[model samples]
Target: MTPTPHDLPADLDVFLAAAGWAGATVEPLQGDASFRRYFRVRKPGDKTAMLMDAPPPNEDPGPFLRAARWLDANGMRAPHILADDAARGLVLLEDFGTARMRDYLDQWPDDETAIYTAAVDALVRLHDLPPGPFLNYSMSEYQREARLFTDWYCTARDLYVDAGGFSAAWEAVLGDLLPRQRPGVTVLRDYHAENIMLLGALEKQGLLDFQDALVGHPAYDMVSLLQDARRDVPPELEARMIDHYVRAAGVDKDTFLADYARLGAQRNAKIVGIFVRLWRRDGKPRYLELIPRVWALLERDLAHPALAPVAAWFDANVPTALRESLGGRFEA
Candidate 1:
C-alpha cells in the first residue's frame, strides 16, 4: 500500500491547497514503524510545517489529532495541528525542526546528563497532570501484550514453554505489581529519545509518537526513556535520572524502582514479539537487528527481586543457553 511519487505529490498538493498553502513545496521526512508518512512543507514566506499522510485502510489520524489537542491544552510540547482531514487521514502539523534528540545526542554526548534530565523533567510534568482523555493501561491490557512474546517468538523459534505455568507466573507478577500502580499518570508508551525532539527550550524536548498515550503507572514512561530499546542508556546515568525524578516528584524510591523493573520487563517482552513479527510476517528484516539489545534489557529487568515469578518462568522455560542465543532471522 505504499504511495507512488505521483500519488503522494498530487495528494500533497490538494491537502496543501485546502490548508491555504496553494504552492508549498514538500520534502520527504523520515517515518516511523507505522504506515504513516511525513512531508516537510515549505511555502515562500511562511514557516515550514509538517504534513502527515496517514492513508486510510491502513492508518488513521483521529487518535493523533485528539492526542495533539489534548497535549496542547495540557501544557505539553506536541506538534500543533494546523488543519486535518480525518476521513482522508491527512493533517498539516507544526514542524519542530530536524533536531531529533537521538541525532542531537550523537553530536554532543557530553550533554547526556543535561538532555536526559530535561527529558525526565518533562515526564514528571506529564505524570503530574490530572487524569484526562486517554486509554487505561489495565492489567488485562498488560497481560495481553506480554502474551505476544509467546504467540510469536516462542512459536517461531520452536521454543517449548509451559503455557499454563507461564500464564500463572505472569499472573503472579502482574498481581503483585498492578495493585501498586497509581492509575492517573499520562504514560506516553514510546517515551524514548528518538521520539523526543531537542528543541533547546526550557522544556527541552518536543514530544512525538504519543498517539499511544494512556493512563498508567508514572514509572512506565520513566522506564521507556531510561531503558531505551534502540539505544544503550548508561547505567549510572539511568540511576541518576531515576534519583532526579524521585526527588522531583517525592515518590517512594524503592517502590518506584520495582515498578519500573516490572513494567520494563513487560514492555521488553512485548517488543521482542513485535520485532520478530515485523520480520516473519511483515517482511521487514531490519527490525530483527534490535532483538539482542531488547533481550538483554529484558534479562536485566528479570534480575529484579520483584520479578521472581516472571524470572522463574524464564528460567524454567527460556533457559540460559536460549536466552544467550538472542533473536534474528529465526528458521521455521
Candidate 2:
C-alpha cells in the first residue's frame, strides 16, 4: 500500500529513531516537480541535516545515493549522506544551507558573472572525470525526450503535429554528434540554478537533483545551466560562459557551439512538454507561466544551422502566433 502524506511523518519518525535522530525537529522543505519530499531536521547542539523522503513505488532513493557517492568520491560537492534507508526511501544528508544559486543571484545581481563563470568551471572539472555508472544519453533517449514537445505541449495546444517526423528530425540532427560524445562525461541532466547551492565562495557549488544523471556530451550540462527554464540568463553572459568552458576544456569552438545549440533546442523542447504535463496531467498550472520563456529560448536555439531539421519541423507545425500566445491561456 502507498503511504499518504499523513502517514509519512510517522514513518519518518521510525526511520529517524532507528538512525539515532529520534527527536530531531522536522520542518518541511519545498518539494520539486518529483514525488519526493524533503525536511530540514534540527536537534540540540546546533545539529542539522536534510531528510529526503522519496517514498517507494513512486520514487526511489537508490539512484540519488549512487550518484551522490560517485560525485562525492570524485571530489565534487554533492551533499554528504549521513544515513540512508533505501527500502523506506529515507535519507539523512548534511545540510548545505539556504543559499541556492537562483536565490543568491536574485539578491545580488552584480555577482552573476562571477557565479556563472564558477558554474562553468565546475562543469569543466566534472567533465574531466570519467562518466558515472548510468545509461548512455543515446540517440533514442534524445529522440524520446524531444518527442515530449509533440506528446504533451502540442497535444495541449490542440496542434496536430507529425510525431514520427518529429522523431526523425531529432535523429537527423543528433546522429553524427553522438560519435563525438563517446565515453562521454557524466551529464547532470538538471544543472540549472535552482538545483545548485552556493556553499561559500564561487568555487563551492553544491549539486542537487542529479538522480537522473547520464553519460552524455559535455555540452549538455552547459546548455542546462545557460538555457535555464526557471530563470533568464543574459545572452551576453551565456556566450561568455560558453567561451569560458570551450577555452578551459580546450575544445574546438565551432563544433562545441553547434552541439550546444542543438542540445539547447532539444532540451527546451522537452521542457515545454514537461511544463505542459505538469499542468494538464499533474494539475499544477503555475508551470505553464514559464512556457513563454522556454519558447523564446527555443526560438534562439532553432536559429542555429545545426538545429535546422528540428527547426523546420517546428516551423511547419507550431505556428509563431500559437507559440507567442501561450501566456495566460493554460492557466484558465
Candidate 3:
C-alpha cells in the first residue's frame, strides 16, 4: 500500500522538506526485526534515497553512521550517508538498488558459488583491517548471549534449569574459544544473505544492517554468514566457503574450525531463545515457524567436540520433543 502523508511520522514531513525531497514519493520497504522503519524516496527527476526512521530511546542512527564510515574507509560498500536529523532519529542514505543477495540466489541457485565466493572474499578483506574504532566483542557479551537460551527458550517450554550452572558451562567453553579469536578484527555481526545486496557492475556487493558491527573473533562473522538462521546453506557450499575463507585468511585451520563450531552453537542457541521471546513476549508468533530450522542448526553446532559442556547442558535441560515443537504451529 502507498504511504500517504498521514502514514508517516510527524517529523518526517519537515525532515524531507528540508532535504529537498518535500514532494518526493515514499514507498515503504521491508524492514528488519528492529524498531526501525525504511522507505524508498523518489524525486521527479529520478533522484532517489533510502530513508531510515530510527526513533530515539529505542534506536539511534549513530552506530549505523559510524559503521558506514568505517566500512567505506576499509574499502567496503556500505551505503553513503546523504543527510541526517540526529535529534529526530532520521537519516537519508544512498540507494543501493533492489537486488538483495537472498532473492537473487532464490532466482538463480546455480550462481551460489559465485556470489558466496565474492561475499567470503569481501569479508576476508574486512577482517584483514585493524580493529580500532569498533567496540570489542567481549567474553561477557558472548556469555550473556548464550544465557538467553536458558533465560527465555526454556521458559517457553515450561522448564527451568540452574542459571548459575548454565553460566558456568558456557564460561568453560568460551574460556578456550575467546582467547583464540584473533584480536583486532572487525566483525560484522550480521553478514548473512538477507542483509547483503548485489550491486551489479558498480560494486561487488552492498552491505546493510551493520550498526551492530564489533571488533572480535573472525570466526563469528563467518559462521553468521554460512550457518544462517533464515536460510539453509547447502553442506557442500558451506564447506567450500569455509575452506575458501580459511585459505584466503591464512589462519590456523584447526583453531578456526573449532572456534567456528563454538561460535555457531553460541549464536544459534541465542537465536532459539530470541525466537521464543518474540512469540510469547512480543506477540509476533510467525517467527516460531523458524524454530525447527534453528534447532537443527543448533544441533549441528553442538556436535563439535568444543561444545561438549554446552551440549551436555542442552541434552540435560531441553528435551528433543520440546526442541522440535513450535508454539504457533501447534496453535494452528
Best model number under lDDT: 2
lDDT (Cα) of model 2: 0.89
Q: Alpha-carbon error at 244 in model 3, in Å?
A: 0.4
For model 2 the local lDDT of residue 189 reads 95
lDDT for every model?
A: 0.85, 0.89, 0.84
lDDT ranking, high to low: 2, 1, 3
* Cα misplacement distance, residue 5 of candidate 2 (Å): 8.8
Candidate 2: 10-residue stretch with minimal lDDT: 323-332
Residue-by-residue lDDT tens digits, candidate 1, 1-332: 44457757346677788888887777777678888888888888866999888888888899888888998998989999999988898899999998888888898899889999999999888878886588888877888889899988898878888877877877887777666555568788999989999775636679999888788888888888988988889999999999999999999999889888899999999999988888788777788788898888899999999999999888888857768776544542
Task: List ranges where model 1 is wrong by over 4 Å.
Answer: 1-4, 7-10, 328-332
* Full candidate order by TM-score, most accurate first: 2, 3, 1
Clashes of each: 0, 0, 0
Tens-place lDDT digits, model 3, residues 23-95: 8888998777778999999999889999999988889889998999889887889999888987778999999
Candidate 1: which pairs clash? none
Q: Give model 3's TM-score versus the native structure.
A: 0.95
Best by TM-score: 2
Error of 1 at 270 (Å): 0.7
Question: What would the per-residue lDDT of candidate 2 be over residues 67-125, giving only the tens digit for each residue?
Answer: 99999999999999999999888899989999999999999999999999999999999
Q: Against the correct fold, how does model 1 do in TM-score?
A: 0.94
